[model samples]
Target chain A: MRIIAFASGKGGVGKTTIVANLGIALARQGKKVLMVDTDLAMANLSLILGMETSPITLNDVLKGDAGVWDVVYDGPEKVSIMPASLGLQDTQRLDLTKLPGIIKQVAPKYDFVLLDCPAGIGEDTLAAMASSTEVFLVVNPHSLSIADALKTKIAAQRINAKPVGLIINMYAGLKGEIPERDIISMLELPLYGVVPYDEEVRKTFYYKKIQPVILRNPDAEASKAVYVVAGKILGIEIDIKKQGGGFFAWLKRLFSR
Target chain B: MGLFSKLAFKLLGIDDTELPAEQIGYIKDISKEYSVPEILKNTFGEFVDSLLHKHLIEGVVVFKENSLIYSSSPDILELANKLYEMFSSFKRENKVLYFNVGSWVSMFEKDEFVYMIKSDTRLCEFELNAVAKDIAVHGKNIFLEEYRKIMSFVKV
Candidate 1:
């Protein structure tokens, strides 16, 4: 029962994207995975997994209105998702301290439990971090992002939830971008993976279905990098599952930037 | 601080690792019916609904000993955590606690609990005293109603 939180000190570093793709990749490797949208306030893991209106969400379980198992929804391959509620009213009267116990109830059944944490270190964010066994900080290649990730790392340590590693997202390899080695040194954590900035990753959200990049176009740079992260976690090599659309697939990725 | 930790902090122009927004944002536990803030809020809300209906008061938050029982806004919830230290002073002489921090605030106690009322305008100290008396008795009814709901609905 390895419960891990994918957190970003600042917003928009592809935290949700990495969690969704990694969950799918792990599931493909014959590992039981459960991805939870712990962000209660602004949830998107459900959207990427193609579950827009999840009738039962983590909100219900926190409020003690529903059982933890009752809210678990099946995702791509063998992955199970406990998505956060989309409704505005779902965030009300939530007792987040009960989260650890709720995760504990269902954690034994799965090999991996991935928490999609909310941005900013508010009460909601703290609750998610406290509920997980370890935290993985996500940052972009820049000074401010690294600075924020450092604060997130310290916060995780104070609560006794060790921040195990770092994942650099949207690496464009442009000038003025902090080198990956510098990011690792400043954050003082091992680098798990680096996801290259890819347009195909954006198409998953822009297109009709709102699927994960790993499923929509496995050959995409962002998808391959995410699989590598998943493979490292699962201790196995992953061969991208290719669904042949060939030239038309290239056309789809090109236009959906 | 390590070599890189100090470098990142210096480069970003921030010295403190603790961000103001990163405080522990919840009551330590919820299964203890006496400690749940929502139940206290709902119970006190019912008692103050008439004043709220008349627009005489903006809102009311209830706190029992240390735990904040209820607050209308999430922003105000953090304020409750800062208030426990001040509550001890109210036990001896300060029958009615008043402060003006943007919103007019008043706190009066009844037994082990304290009720905080927020108003747009400054309220007369004597007048607040009388209202506090009425609430002390009325707070009992609201407690019964909330407790019944919690007993039936909540497991934790």
Candidate 2:
């Protein structure tokens, strides 16, 4: 089982959303995937996975209030999410150091265990890193994001946690944006995949919308990019929904399925 | 210092930007090879590398019966003495003290020894309920490496 922490230095970079979608995508590939919301304070993974009402969350587990199995809820696309409590009070007084031991207890049951680390290098972020075997830095195409990501990568290294690669998410292909190669050179990690900006990512989970963009719109550019990254992780080339323009792309997407 | 040098110190895991320059050098003197006292080496022995590598703990000051025991720097010795003089009335075993502005030094007392551990962040909700008696069990190092860089400037 592979326990990977998805961390980024900055917030509002869609770390939680990508982790949720990736968990679903991996689960669709017949791999038992568990997505743990280690953000603790500002948690939205449970809501994204449509399992926000899970009474026993990772907060309970970390606080010794509940067992690990008790908090594991079945998510959409057969993904198992150890969500964090939405309650503001639940974030307080948690024995976060136990996260490593807790992850060890549940790791044997899943092929991919993705942890959504809280933004910035907080104590909670360190706990999440300590729990995971490796870290995947999620960066956007920009200097600010890359700079923050470098610090996050260094933070991961301090704890002896291996930061595996970079998944450049939310790439808009803007003219002045930092290119993928430069990002790779700066962060010093191999490219996992680049998820282009897709409106479907926001439209699906804006407020009450719970379906992840990957499953809701597999034909979406972002979804297809996620599949390619997932395929790389699985060590196999996946059949992505073909991209083109208008009618031809529609036909390719339909026939490719 | 410039951004590049700051980044370099941060990359070295000895950058504590939280603390000001005078009390502790912004760029901690991690390069200076200081000898570990024979008594401290006997108490902590070979554990320095593990702490330095695995954690970012600034420095571990073990004060025995209000007497300086482990801290190498005389300045920290003065601060530790002031800490005891200032907060002696408080009977709490685990207390977070303001040894320096922007830096939180947590004191864990057991028997007669005071284990003052400097950790980055968590000044408000800072308390290690565990590791009160035994300092070795502190699992949360939190940016103490940067703390140590600032601490290394504490001259004996």
RMSD of each: 15.9, 12.2
Candidate 1 per-residue C-alpha lDDT over B29-86 given as tens digits, one digit per residue, 9 for 90 to 100: 1112111111123445454564353325676666764556656456666555555457
DockQ of all models, two decimals each: 0.02, 0.06
**lDDT tens digits, residue span A58-92, model 1:** 99999989998999998877799999988888899
Identify the candidate with maximal DockQ: 2
lDDT of 2 by residue, B1-156 (tens): 899988997798663423122312211232112211111222333444344333355556665555555663455666666676666667464444555635667665654556666657442221233223124344213224324444666543
DockQ of 2: 0.06
The global C-alpha lDDT for each of the candidates, from Candidate 1 onward, is 0.73, 0.71
Runs in model 2 with CA error above 4 Å? A206-209, A241-257, B1-58, B61-103, B106-116, B119-156
- Mark the regions of model 1 whose C-alpha exceeds 4 Å error after superposition: A239-257, B1-156
